[model samples]
Target: MSLIAAASFFGWLVGPLAGGYLAQYGAAMAFQVAAVAVFLCMIFVATVIKETHKVSNEQSFLSLFKSNNSLTLLSHPNILNLFVLQFFSVLV
Candidate 1:
């Protein structure tokens, strides 16, 4: 978790600087670079990342979105705090 957080922090820190440099080439070029990066990330996840947990065949995908499970998660203090933080961050 610490490594993940550190990596995320560094990514956020560097993203703006990298984007500013890329933008000098042109807005379209910057967007194209971003799109290619996203495509490569998708490909990496699809091929390199392996699923460790066996998903139960019985559960429909929609079951994952059931309100009861969501409410249960929100009932936790830590989760609720995180939710609120994310909500306000998006507003900003």
Candidate 2:
């Protein structure tokens, strides 16, 4: 968790520096560069990464939302209480 937090913090810190460097060229060029970088990353992930988890034939991903299962889960007392707390916290 700490590693994730640190990485996220550093990413936020460095992102502006990268943008600032790119902005010296032009806003349009900066946007194009960012777009190309994202495209390259997507391609790399799609080609290089393999899925490890095998899904059972019987269990579909939509099983969680089938019937009233999703509603039933959300309507639990503990979940309702958490929702209420979150609402109040955000309201404040």
Candidate 1 collision pairs: none
Q: Lowest-lDDT window of 10 residues in candidate 2?
A: 64-73
| RMSD (CA, angstroms), candidate 1 | 5.0
Please report the candidate that would top TM-score against the real structure. 2
lDDT accuracy of residue 58 in candidate 1: 75
Instruction: Evaluate residue 57 in candidate 2 and report its C-alpha lDDT on the 0 to 100 scale.
Output: 61
* Candidate 1 positional error at 7, Å: 2.1
Candidate 2 runs further than 4 Å off: 1-8, 52-72
lDDT of 1 by residue, 1-92 (tens): 99999988987977777789998898888778878878998999999999999966676767766843667788889999999999999999
The candidate that achieves the highest lDDT relative to the unseen native structure? 1
